[model samples]
Target: MVKWVLALVGYFIYRFPGAIAGYLIGTLIDSSFESNKKSGRKGFDTVFTTSRSQNVSPSDFELNLLSLASIVIKADGSVSQTELDYVRAYFVQAYGKERANATFKTFNDVIKNREVSAQRICTYLNSRTRYEVRLQILHFLFGIAQADGRVSSPEVSQLSSIAGFMRINQNDFKSIKAMFVKDANNAYKILEIDKTATDAEVKKAFRTMAKKYHPDKLQHMDEAYQKGARDKFQKVQEAYETIQKERGF
Candidate 1:
């Protein structure tokens, strides 16, 4: 409508060239306005969706962690008090006494019902969490499984299955398992290095493992989770020390 009006006015005032120029200018302005309106809607939708998704907070993370912990604890067809204590201490340390007491009931119910599936939880976590964070979670689960002094074959199989669902690499899963499974008895495996490697290669592997498993890398996590990472970091350091002592380095 506006373009036709502009063109007619232009034709009366200055004939063909003026009509062409006016119509072109009007069409350009109309197209640009429509494009901006569409972009505005898209921008708003993006912001709203992102904010909604990011609403998954640290407490939510802890809940999911506890839920998955329960599943892992029951993997061997038994649930030990030691494993439950490990999880309880985690919540108490991370969420404080009051919150832990409140959340424990839910954790207990989840365990009693046996309704949560490890694979489903792992799938959800994989979709939502970063790889580093998922690795840390796997480390935590291994710690819980070993809290009773040993990680059973069934528990190891369950951990491996969870890692697979989480899209964690097999080598990375084995690296974490080596830290806890003493039956392997190989510091080289703990450091994830070749037995025949030179001292320099061993030192390099230690540094790499140290950096990758550092607790500080998990500062964004809850304090309890950070403590779990610190424990793993110490284990890595211990493995390195053991290698150095045995090799007389």
Candidate 2:
């Protein structure tokens, strides 16, 4: 009985430490792996900011869509060097060097070979990405169009078609377009003031207009009148934002 008891004690002692050591080793390995993976992901994200966007698969239909919009931007028989450069830069930023270059070549070839419909591109994008993503994509496209410091009519038309394809409500698209056009108006005139206006004067002008054209208050007016009021109000707000951006107010 004594020998048997001693043998059992010896077995328990060996197994217990082995189990504890294994658990400790497993936990350490797991923690180390997780930490390394997190660091790697952070590194990748940092690189991605500088690298071109390559998230979309080559087989995805958005590629053709983007190409068509770009072609339309240059449709006036005169694609400015600046515009071409902007397109190249954007693709590079989105896809990285090699892929971006390849995609650009494809874009060039596709634009020459076929006439892809802008509406179809938008529709495909809308079906692919969520509404919010579509909005962001549209904003990026707009940024590209404005990169040349001048937005062409074709670019505007392409954007309008994109908005329609994204299923952005007609009213919202109209509102946004009006805002863009009104913004192109003389900033000083939009504020109903001049460069001579003091900081206080600018602030007062903005406050008066913001309150007068508040969308909430416009609800009581006729729909058409309300839209007009809102557009005017947007101009005033944009004027203020512009001045703020320029540090004029």
Candidate 3:
């Protein structure tokens, strides 16, 4: 990201060769900074967040997320304290404790009483965020649904609706859903491959899924967001290993 920004500046200021030099410099800086961060010498960007929604304020993002969580918690006809606590804890970890508390307060006072419109919210979100980020949000909602240890039928229906509204394709929705709602040892389903897939095809699917779910892609968000991503990434790895063990290859 730094490289791209600097390379663009260099292109304007000094042409093609300067762009190359800028990129080389930016690479070193990015790498050194990443190393410092990993070693705990550097800290999180004090900026809590800005959504891809450039026009809307960032607090809208937090409010919408809490609204979605509320919808999921109430989907099963009764709210579970466990699910509510799970959402709070996740926010506390992903954002900060103060921000999470304020967001939840706003949800209760403003968004929670209104009819939750998944379609309207998703239409607003789909344009701003990348497909990958929406997928992560869907995964997070599923985490909420299953926080009490089981996803109810109503919750599943609500999740499916949200996924559709977010424009998540059927296959991607099924793949994530399989993780939260499992039956009959469905590793193949989780991988979005068939039991009869060729070994090469299975391997190919696993690689694609692994890359898609990699925590590095979400590293800019926050530690908790990356940790959530790792949950999905590990599931991909586990499915692959199960298949590999079964096939003995």
Best by lDDT: 3
lDDT of 1 by residue, 6-71 (tens): 456456556898677557654543454356456652211121122237433333455567778887
User: How many backbone clashes does every candidate have?
Assistant: 0, 6, 0
Identify the runs in model 3 with alpha carbons over 4 angstroms from their true place. Answer: 1-56, 109-112
Better of 2 and 3 by TM-score: 3
Which portions of model 2 miss their true places by more than 4 Å?
1-62, 171-249
User: Candidate 1, which segments miss by more than 4 Å at Cα?
Assistant: 1-53
Candidate number that wins on lDDT, 1 or 2? 1
Which structure among the candidates has the greatest TM-score?
Answer: 3
Per-residue alpha-carbon lDDT of model 2 for 1-249, expressed as tens digits? Answer: 222322343344456553454344334433543564566522122211212343332224325535655655555555566666766766555445554554454345344444657776665455445443444455455555666775678778777777777787654454345444445435655556666788888899788757755656535322432444555677778778887777644
Clashing pairs in 1: none
- lDDT against the true structure, each candidate: 0.72, 0.53, 0.76
TM-score of 1: 0.73
Worst-scoring 10-residue span by lDDT in model 2: 42-51
Candidate 1: C-alpha lDDT = 0.72
